[model samples]
Target: MVKKQNIPAKEKIVSVVLLAGLILFMAIVIGPGFSEPSSPNQNVAEQMLPAGWSAVGGWEIYPKGRLYEKINGREPLFDQYGVVRLRYASVSKGTNDFEVYFYDMQTPDGALGIYLANTPSEFDELELGTLADISGGQVRVLKGRTYLEIFSLAEQTPKDFLIDLSSALVETIPTEKEARRTAVELLPKQGRVRGTLILNRENTYGLAKLTDIFSASYQQDNDEFDYMIRTISPSEGRKMIAAVGEEIFEFDGEIIQSETNSLVAEFMGKTLILNQTGDFLIGLYGAVPPDQGRRRLDQWIETMKDQLHGSGK
Candidate 1:
């Protein structure tokens, strides 16, 4: 038998330290990790638009909780049922004063859709959706892919409306080669009169009179024709160039040189320029008889429209 004794203070201290270390090691090995919280807008967007339909750059959420996206740096708009409608303030000037819509329609080939002038025009009957162009600046999704169309209550004549509308119509929709041929027959023959029409999936078109045609070193030292247009998709500057060789001829041309999901095409003297990215088609038409050119452009646009509808780009 031995007498029991109280533990020394030094021994008690060492035992407590060892027990604490064991507990710390177990916590570190088994505990869960921490993470940061997500933003409110991102959370809302994830819940809204269909999967993969994310907000592109330059999009903002308004105080009312609505999301607005800008088009070509001019208007702030919202999308509803695949239709883009823009509301203009009273202070806005010119044909800049309207609402615009973008949508798809069912066609014989598939779906024919585009941007349209929804205003009080004689062509409204040709529109595929409900007319929503109440304001002078409003546009409705009509028959063709209208990249851009402006409206103005200040104009004394329908000339401005017609010019914009015709340009938009001609750029996105395909023309009948026969109709263009007939139209060409009516023009007065002269030096090579050249015009080009371009369409992109972003619902935009560029119509230009090609005068100064030249070649320059483009994208990674390739030589291609340089031309001009009245207007183009503002975002197209950075999109990728698609086709480089001429469609009907071997003439060299370059498509968009930047990072773009859009398509581009150019035509010079009956030569066709075709560039495509994703489901968008870009076409260029050069010098041809007036009627013939118009018809051909229209027919081509029709074909492209069909392609876009079928592909849903």
Candidate 2:
């Protein structure tokens, strides 16, 4: 029998401490009892609606369970936005008919995401509640926990009628206590394309692991590319960086720059960069000529840092 070698006492103590820390970390990440509350089943469709407009018919409420059955093909999109409830109404004012749809999303951000996804390019920004966008025949608004979509069936429906209805509804809904400026606001406006910012609530850039990401189009030297960013807890940010590192390595990507807090990789005929700073994971994707990408990222970092710090966020 061979003699057994004993581990050093100090080394054993260190190992024990590390193992305990690992257990605690895992517990915090995956432990039970931290689940979010289920959406309420109540329907408030007719609660605060204005009474002046004659109801062409009664309102229909689709609770969380029935939303899929009601919306059919578009159920997946509503689910992606964390929809809790939906209300629909059909009314007529003289010769004009209107179809009013009210969506009860889980949060303001969720409502905003749905609003962005549904609105068209010609919608004009309206000064109502958190944000409101109106087109010639449609009006969409994002308030505290709801998104309102009012569609005018007749071409003759006056824009004033749409504005009045939107205003009335906004006044009834609760608004956010304080408006939170989003990370998208920090993007440099110099080379950015207008109306190109997209807030993805799910499956951002086909990366299922990454959700609630914001992407925008940018132009440099007539070359168009997209960049994305998502704000998460510092711990989660670091974990995401580690996961992405593995993915890039598997794709045979070269790491051009690696540091304690930042990583830059070149892959698939393009350059991609990832950085974490104070609970934010910022990235530049599809940039050519590594140097240009780096410069753009540096500029974005500087601007975001200044803006966020100055705002005391």
Candidate 3:
């Protein structure tokens, strides 16, 4: 009692093709999300062992809790750097043992934060990435989001072995050399202590909101003192000046009023001066007198201004 309708052969064929295309599109776009998420880097354990050594033990992951235990209770320092994870393993060949630690920082800057804070001595620079320093039978490399430290379990292990292992790891971990300049570059190369540029990431010198500070040691008359600069926006510069003002009062230190915002304070037998110039908060720490500190600070500020102008900042 019902009239029957049939699709044309060509129309049926077109519908089938369209349905097939839609399914294919969904498969391509939505299928991968259904699978497990991939790891950050290629399996580090596989690339760790070199030609002459074997992994002494299985790879271990140290999340927040275990990470605190592994670094000799320096958790606060690592935390400030925004560490996401730590991966470690040991390798041995014959009697020589090597320990490798990979700190998976949240970002390149975070990795740089820890590297600068550690006060490493410079030995040989590597082509692996932005910064690498080899010292005391160990190698520290900062590449992208990873900070790697390879050291001998016993200082008896050969340095060449550490270098070889590090080279392998560097080739495996996916990272390109950092191309951007950093605030530390503003410091004049002359008279800056080698490998002493440190980025203090938080609460620098017990002053609240005093952070992102880059400091380096300078030598005059063979006396070592530290000079530091914190880069802030021109708007935030006023806030820093106010914070330093309040801090000076809290510490019972005298504030040296000047046309250029600066203050003189004595803390623990060392004279400290905080200066604000444009978008920078500058500080000098050590036994330098106020006049000498001001002179040195002015020179640094001028040098930074010259560098900034040259770079079009």
Candidate 4:
């Protein structure tokens, strides 16, 4: 036996809440789309390389069943070169990030250079085996092997995509050799200096020692012998004549010239020129000044001529 009573507004509210919960449960279990899994295609273009820049030359396209415009010499984001690779992946919850890996190329000695890793925690992490950094909206290798990687937390546009690709391309291109040559020229020279000798290595050039023989000195910093030895072969005499044309002098039975501020003696047998441009000595080695030295110089010149002819023979 029960007395029927009107439900209060609060009770009605409770009933409504329970009914909504049941409806939600039914929707979860039997919704029309629930049985058919939704396969949304990932918009990779919006996720990777920027526009206009194609991965030309040395790159491979990835992902199965997808078509990409072939850009020669272009590479994938994870590709490697010269024992280095760049790896990129989107984070599930945290900030976007990527990594750089450096590996030692196989060496004959069997000792490997260390591996390096760079990650986002340090942002500029430089480990023994890897190095990585994020800059200008791109993750680039400053010191480690592989050059650059561009990814996006936002949609990737063609513009952004090409920006990354261009970076990689720029990194891969060979540096100009002239710049390297100039750098080498700027480097200090170091070597031993011997007594002055005509360095006729292919051409007659002069070499004067700035230091004692076997001593070390920087060529860039120290003064070098003025002229290289002129001729190594007697057959090269005509060419030498052309090279020294009209600058010749007839002294001690030899044709000599003063060119580039140094006396150039050619096929001379006697009477060496002692024209002191300054205090520098130019006579035959071990010979003193004036007449007595002149005789010795003449003899020495004859010996040189004989050596040259014998070598040719």
What C-alpha lDDT values do all the predictions have? 0.31, 0.72, 0.71, 0.31
Number of colliding residue pairs in each model: 32, 0, 0, 41
Model 4 segments more than 4 A misplaced: 1-73, 76-88, 95-134, 148-150, 155-313
Q: Candidate 1 has what TM-score?
A: 0.19
CA displacement after TM-score superposition, residue 129 of candidate 1 (Å): 12
The clash number for model 1 is 32
Candidate 4 Cα lDDT to native: 0.31
Evaluated with TM-score, which candidate comes out highest? 2
> Candidate 3: where is the Cα deviation over 4 Å?
1-77, 89-97, 107-109, 116-137, 143-145, 153-155, 167-178, 184-214, 222-224, 250-252, 258-272, 275-280, 289-291, 302-313
Local accuracy of candidate 2 as per-residue lDDT tens digits, 67-171: 654567887888888898887777666677788777999876677778778869686788886668888888888777788888898876788888887787777
Give candidate 2 misplaced runs (Cα > 4 Å): 1-61, 68-72, 91-95, 119-136, 183-191, 199-212, 220-223, 302-313
TM-score of each: 0.19, 0.67, 0.59, 0.18
Q: After superposition, how far is residue 221 of candidate 2 from its true place, in Å?
A: 6.3
Over 67-179, each residue of candidate 1 has an lDDT whose tens digit, in order, gives 23324422322132133332221112233332222222222011111232122443322222221232333333333222323344354435445344433433444433332
Winner by TM-score between candidate 4 and candidate 2 = 2
